[model samples]
Each structure stands twice: as structure tokens, then as C-alpha cells.
Target: MELDCTAVIADVWLMLDGECDESTRARLQHHMDTCSPCIEAYGIEEKIKGLLSRKCGGDRAPDSLRDRLTLEIRKSVTVTRIETTEA
Candidate 1:
């Protein structure tokens, strides 16, 4: 049977969070057993989640840093919009 990539991505969050029922987990596992690309994608996502959790889990950000980051992001967005419009 061919596996649906859309369904797999949609269910990935549920599977990672342990919210999927046993049957759904089994089905996903069965697909992963034979699909290398999906397995690689899942691994990359898992690593990203782990890194984010470790980075932002308990660190309290300073207000000054937060404000600076917000300003930088807004500037970046404006630049991106201008570039896209010119293109």
C-alpha cells in the first residue's frame, strides 16, 4: 500500500505528543518501517523539538533583549516585503 505524505505529516504531531491511539501509532510505525524518507524527516523534527525544548524550556529572557529582537524581526519583515514587491 502507498503511504500518504500529507497524512503522515498531519499525524506527526499527534504521534510525537503521544496523543495518537494505539492503532494509529501502529499504522504510522508500520509505514515508517519501510519508508526511509519519512523516518529521516521524523528524526529531524525530533531533534529540532529537543533542541528547542532545551534552549527555551526554563530560561527567562531579559526585557531589553526581547524588545531588541522584536524590532529586528519587524525590520526583517519589512525588508522581505520590499524585496518581494520589487521582484
Candidate 2:
């Protein structure tokens, strides 16, 4: 199956956070292995996630903030999915 970089980029956090299934992780990693843009995006996302983890290692986000972030992430993923499929 062909991989969509936008979808892969959107799921970078999922891969980094170990939230995806093994097959999904393998698929993403394989795409990164061959796709420079995706790997680059993944690297940037990895750094951001690492920074967030270090800054807020033990702290929980406020419910409002967490809800906002989740909503925004879903919106982004939804848009990415739509754009990728339409292309």
C-alpha cells in the first residue's frame, strides 16, 4: 500500500507516544525510511514531544487546555486525512 505523507506526519505523535499498533508503527517507520519529508517532519515532531515531556514530565494539563489541544489535533488529523485522500 502507498503511504500518505500528510497522514504519516499527522500520526508522528502517535508513533512517538507508542499509541499506534505495531503494524501501524512499522508502516510509518518504513515510510520514514524512504521518505525524506516525512522523516524530517517526524524528527521535528519528536523534538517537540521530547521538549513537552521534559517540561511537563509529571504535570497534567488543565482539563480545558487538554480538551482544546485534543480538539485541535483531531481537526488537524481530519484535515490532513481529507487532503491526502483527495490528492
Maximum-TM-score candidate: 2
Top lDDT model: 2
After best superposition, candidate 2 residue 9: deviation in angstroms? Answer: 0.6
RMSD of each: 9.9, 3.5
Model 1 CA deviation exceeding 4 Å by range: 58-87
Residue-level lDDT tens digits of model 2 in 16-85:
9788999999999999999998899889988987888899876867979956875688688779778878
For model 1, the local distance difference test gives: 0.70
- Local accuracy of candidate 1 as per-residue lDDT tens digits, 5-81: 54564456567868789989888878878888778867876787678779898675697985686566556656765
TM-score of each: 0.59, 0.73
For residue 54, what is the lDDT in candidate 1?
Answer: 94
Model 1 pairs whose backbones collide: none
For candidate 1, the TM-score is 0.59
